[model samples]
Target chain A: MRVSYYPGCSLEGTAKSYDISVRHVCRSLDIQLEEVPTWACCGSSPALKMNRLLSTALSAHNLALAERQNLSDVVAPCPFCFRRLKSAQEEMARDPALRQKVEQTIESQVNGNLTIHNLLGFLTERVGMKAIGEKIRKPLTGLKLIPYYGCYVVKPPSVTCFDDPANPTSLDEILRAAGGEVLDWDFKSECCGAGLSLSKPEKVCELTGRLVRDAAWRGADAIVVVCQLCQANLDLRQREIGLTDKKEYQLPVIYFTELLGLAFGCASEQLGLDRHFVDPLAVLKRKGLA
Target chain B: MFRLTGALSEQEFLHHVVQRSGQNLLECLQCGKCTGGCPIASEKVSGPRRLIAEILSGMRNEALKNPTWWYCVSCGTCMTRCPVDINMYQVATALCELAQEGGIAPSERDIHLFEELFLKSVEKYGRVKELRTVAAYNVITKNPLKDMDKAVTLMRKGAFSPLEILSGWAKDRKVSRIFALARRTSEGGHE
Candidate 1:
C-alpha cells in the first residue's frame, strides 16, 4: 500500500486540484505516499525540441534519487512525467552507451530498477476496483461521466507500455467501479492540444473544442480526466471555445481522483469541487451526487 | 521540379538523424498512416509520409524546411497508429532539434522561445515557477502582457500563487548539479 509518488510541476501550479484529490483519495484508501526528495521538472515536450540529452538527464536525475532512496515502485500521477520517467528507464536499459552518457551528463547513476507506473495503472492494479466499489458510500449513480485518458497516458506501447495503445479500457473500468455511468465516446484517448495553448491558443481551442463538443453531444454530464495538462487545457479554455464556436457547451471537466473522492463519501471541500473553471459542482448538484 | 545535387550531404544528414533518433527512416513503408493521423497535417504543407520520404531521399532541406515539425504536438498519435512501428513522432522531434541547430527559422517562434524559457526556468528554480516562466517568455517574445489575463484568473481561483515559486530552493543543491553536468555535456564535453 506504499509507493513513491512523483507529482510533477503541473500538479502544484495549474493542477492543484489533482494533487489535493490524489492525496485525499490515497489517504482514504490507506495508500502511503512518499514524495521524491527535491524533484525537478521532467522537461516535458519542450525539452524534446531543446535537447534530448537535457530531457533524459532531468528524468534520470529524479530516477536516480528514487533509487538512492531505495523505493522500488515509483508512481507518477501526471502522464507527462510518467512518460518521461519511463523513457529515461527504457533508454538507459536499451543503450548502454546512452546510459553511460546520461550518467556522465547528469552525474548520477540510474539503476533502472524502479517500476514506473501511471495513475490509471495504479488505481486499477494496486487499488483494485472491487475495493474501490466497496468504499463508495454514495455511488455516482445518475452522473454520466466520460473518462478522458488523453494521449500520453497510454500510447506508443514501446515507450508507455502500460495499456492497449489504440483501445484503452483501464480508465473506463475505474470509472465504472466508482459507480459512474461510463459512456462510450470516440474522443476518449484523443489529443487535447496541451502545449499549443501558449504557442497557438486558437489551435488548442479547435482541438479541445472537438473533444468537449463530442462529450456534450453524447449527453455526458461532465468529463473526468487524469492528466493535469488536459484538465487545464480543457477546463480553462472551454469557455473561450464556447464563445468562439458560439455554442452553449457547458460541460465541466473534473479530475478522476475528485470524482473518486466523491464516491468515497469525502466532503466537497476535500474534493476541490470549486477549483474547476467551468465549475462541476452545479453539474454534481444537478445529478444529486452532491 | 526537385533538385538532386547534394545527395551525399543529405545522406550524411539523414544518417545523423537516424543515429540520433534511433528510428530507421527505411523502416517506414510510406504507409501514410502517420500523415493520416497527424492533427497538424491538415494545415501543414506536408505530412509525415512526405516528410519521411524527404528525409530518406536525402532532401534534407525539404524535410527540415517544412513547418509540419514546428506544429507537431508530439502527441504520439501517429507513432502509436503506425502499423510499421515507424515512430514518426520521435523523428519529427529530431527534425525540430536539427532545425534549431541548423539556423532554420521555426515557423512558430513562440514554441522555440517557450522551450528556452522552460529549460532556463527549471534549471534555475529546480521546478517551474509559472509567473517567472511567463514573464521571461513574454519579455523576449515582445508581448510582455501575454497571458496576463489568464494568470490573474488562475490566481483568483487559487490555482496559482507566487509563494510556491521558491518552495524547492532549499533542497536544490543536488538538483542544481544535474543541470550543471548536463550543460557540460551539451557543450561537447565527453559525450
Candidate 2:
C-alpha cells in the first residue's frame, strides 16, 4: 500500500531517527511513503495560539499539497504536526468558506490541497494491524511498553478524529500486534510540557521526572511515543532531571515506529537506535526482540 | 438561591461556557471527577467541573473574575480523567484570555514578568536561552537568589551545561518560526 507522507520539520532534523524508522517499517510492511514535496512547518505548537487563521492556513497548505498529489491520506509521524494538519483538514472540510479562505491565504506558501493522518491512524486504519502482525518476524513477547499519547494526538476530537479523547486504544492495538504488552497508565495523555521545556526546564524537569518515574516504577522496559517533542522530553530531559534530582533513571524512550521496525526484524542502524541519547538496543537485545 | 441578571441571554451564556470549556455544561454528571483529578483544584475551592457549572448558569461576572483559573497548570489531568472528556484547562485558558481582553490586570506580578521574559528570550535568541531567561525573570521578579543554589548544584553535577543554555542555529530554526508566527498572530489580535 502506498500513501503520501508528510515528514514535518522534526522528522527532517532532531527526530530524523523517527523518520528513518518509519520509512524502514513502511518498507518492511510493504508500504510506500511518497513524501509530500515542499511541505512547510506545521507552525509548531505556538502557531495555534498565535494566529488560528495563519496556523490553520499553514496546515491547510500541506493538505492542499496532498490533494494536488491525489493522495487522500498523508501519514505524519509527529503528533503536533498530525494534530495541526488533521485539525486544519477537519476544519476546512466542515466549512467550505473557511477552506477557500485558507487556500487563498496559503496559495504561494505550499503546493496542493491535502488530507492528513497521524501515524497511528494510518497504521491502524489504512495498513491494518493484522497486516503488521503478519510482518512481525521477532515477536516482542515479554517486552513491556508504556504507550505515551501526550496531549496533541487525542485532544479536541473535532480535529484529530482518530480515537477516544480520554481513552485511546489505537496505539495499544498496534503494540499488541508486535506481541508487546502495554501498561495502563494515567500519564498517557498528560503533557510533557514540550516547548515549555526550554522556557521552563524546571517545570519540564518536574513533569518529565514524574512521567519517567511513573513509567519506570510501573515496570515498563521502555516508553513509546509518536511526538518528537514527547520523545525528546521523556528520553533526553529525563537524564537531566535524574542528574539534577540525584535520582537514577536511565529509562529508554523509543519511537513507536522503531519498536515496530525491531518487531519486523529490521536492523538497529535502520531504526537509528544508536542516535538516541538513551540506548534502547541493550533492552531490546536482553528481550531477544532486537 | 441566587439570580444572575446579565447582558447575555441564558442560552448565550451556556453556549459561551461550553464553547470555552469544550464540554457540555448541562451534561455534566456532577461526579466531581474534574476536581478529583485536577492537581491545582485539590488545592483550591473552585475546581474546574464546578467552575464550568458556575460559568454556565450566568455567573459570568464571577467566573470571569475568579483567580482560580490562573492556577491551572494545563496538565491535562482533569480532561483525561473526565468521563465526558471536558477540557477544563482550555476553559481556564479561555477565562484567563477573557480577563486579559477585558483589561483585568493580573493580580500577581509574576504573570507579566514571566510573559515578558519568555517573549524576550524567544524574540532575541529565536529560542529560549534558559540561563538568560531565568536570570531576567529573577532580576525582574527581585528573586535573583531563588533557584541559584539548585543551579549551582546541578552545574557541579554536570547536569547543566552552558552550551545547552546558548541557543544554536540548529535549535533556533524551529523555535524562531514559532516565535515569528506568534508575533504576527499577536500583532493581528487573532490570538
Candidate 3:
C-alpha cells in the first residue's frame, strides 16, 4: 500500500486541488503515499519536443530519486509526468548507450526497474476494485458521469502500458464501482489541446469546447477526469466555450479522486471540491449526494 | 549536415527519419487512418498522412517547412489507429528536431517559443514556475494580456500563488548538470 508519489509541477501550481484530493483520498483509502524528495519537472511536452535526451534525463532524475527511496513502485498523478517517467524507463531499459548518457547527465545510477503507474492505474490495478468498493460509504446514486482520460494516461500503447489506448475502461470501472452512472463517450481518451493553452488559446478553446459540449449533450451531471490539464481545460474554459458555441455548457469537471473521496464519505472541503472553476458542488447537491 | 533547400533520396530520408524516431516507416501502408483520427488535422494542417507521404517522396524541405508537426497535439490517436503502429507523435518530434537543426522557420513560431521558454523554466528552477513562465512568454510574445483572466481566476481560486513569481531557485542543483550534458550530447548529434 506504500508508494512513492510524484505530483509534478502542475499539481504544485495550477492543480493544487488535484494534489490535495489525491492525498486526502489516499488517506481515506488506506493507501500510504510517500512523496519523492525534491522531485523536479518531468520535462513534459517541452522537453520532449526540444530534446529527447534531456527529457529522458529529467524523468530519470526523478526515477533515480524514487529508486533512492527504495520503493519499487512510484505513482505519478500527472499523466504527463507518468508518461515521461514510464517512457524514460522504457528507453533506458531498451538502450544501454542512452541509459549511460542519462545516468551521466543525472549523475545518478538508474536501475530502470521501477514500476511507474499513473494515479488511475495505481487505484484500479494496484488497489483492486473490490477493496475500493468496500470503502464507499456514500454511493454516488443518480449522478451521471463520463470518464475523460485525455491523452497521456493510456495512449501511445508502447509507452503507457496500462489500460486500453483507444477505449480505456479503468476510469469507467472505478466510477461504476463508486455507484455513479458511467456514461459511454467517444472522447474518453481525446486530446484537450494540452500545452497549447499558452501557444494557441483559441485552438484549446475549440478542442475543450467539444468535450464540454459533448458531456452536456450526453446528459451527464459532471465530467470525471484524472488529468489536471483536461480538468483545467474542461472546467476553466466552460465560460469561453459557452460564449463561442452560444450554448450554456455548464458542466462541472470533477477529478476521479475527488468523486471517490465523496463516495468514501469525505466532505467536499476535505477533498478540495470547492476549488473547481465550474463548481461541481451544485451537481453533487442536486443528486442529493452531498 | 541536413540541407534546407536540397532534398535527400527517398531511401536516405526514410533511413534518417526512421533512425531518429525509432519508427518503421517501411511498414506504414499510407492507410490514412492516422490522419482520419487526428484531432488537429485541418485544412491548414495536413495531419500525419501528408507528412508521411512527404517523407516517402524524400521532400525534406517540404516536410521540414510543413506545419503539421507544429500543430500536432501529440494525442497518440494516430498511433493507436495506425495498423503498422507508427507513432506519429515520435515522427513529429523527429521532424521538429530536424527542422530546427536545418534552420527552417517553424510554421507556428509561438509554439516553438513556448517550448523554449518552458525548457528555460525547467533549466532555471528544476521545475516550472507557471506564473513566471507564462508571464515571460506573454511578454516575449508581445501579448501581455493573454490568458490574463485565467491567471486572475487561478489566483483567486488559490491555484496560482503570487509568491511563485519570485521562486525560481532549483531545489535540486543536479538539474544544471543534466541540462549541460544534454546540450553537449545534442550538439554532438548523438541523439
**What TM-score, over all chains together, does every model reach?**
0.93, 0.71, 0.95
- Write the residue-wise lDDT of candidate 1 on B46-140 in tens digits: 77888888887887778888777777777788888887677765776678777766788877677777877887778777887666676777788
DockQ of each: 0.61, 0.12, 0.67
lDDT of 3 by residue, A53-144 (tens): 88899999999999988888999999989999988998899999889988888888999889899999999988889899999999999999
Task: Report residue B191 deviation for candidate 2 (angstroms).
Answer: 14
**What range of 10 consecutive residues in model 1 chain A has the weakest lDDT sum?**
A268-277
Error (Å) of candidate 1 at residue B24 is: 0.6
C-alpha RMSD over true interface residues, model 2: 6.7
Candidate 1 wrongly placed segments (more than 4 Å) = B1-6, B142-150, B162-173, B187-191
For model 1, the docking class works out as: medium
- TM-score of the A-chain for all models: 0.97, 0.93, 0.98
Which portions of model 3 miss their true places by more than 4 Å? B1-8, B168-171
**Model with the higher lDDT, candidate 1 or 2:** 1
Candidate 2: which stretches are off by over 4 Å?
A95-101, A107-115, A184-186, A239-246, B1-3, B7-32, B38-191
Better of 1 and 3 by TM-score: 3
Please state the CAPRI-style docking class of candidate 2: incorrect
Tens-digit lDDT string for candidate 2 (A1-290): 77889887567545767889999989888888998766666655444432456567767766766776676568888777887776676667776666665655655333334556788888888889789888989878999999988777886565577688667888988998888998988787777866654445565677788789889889999998988888877876765777877878878888888888888888877787766767687898898766
Candidate 3 per-residue lDDT, tens place, B39-123, comes to: 8888888989888888877888889888888888677889888888888878877887778788888889999899888888888
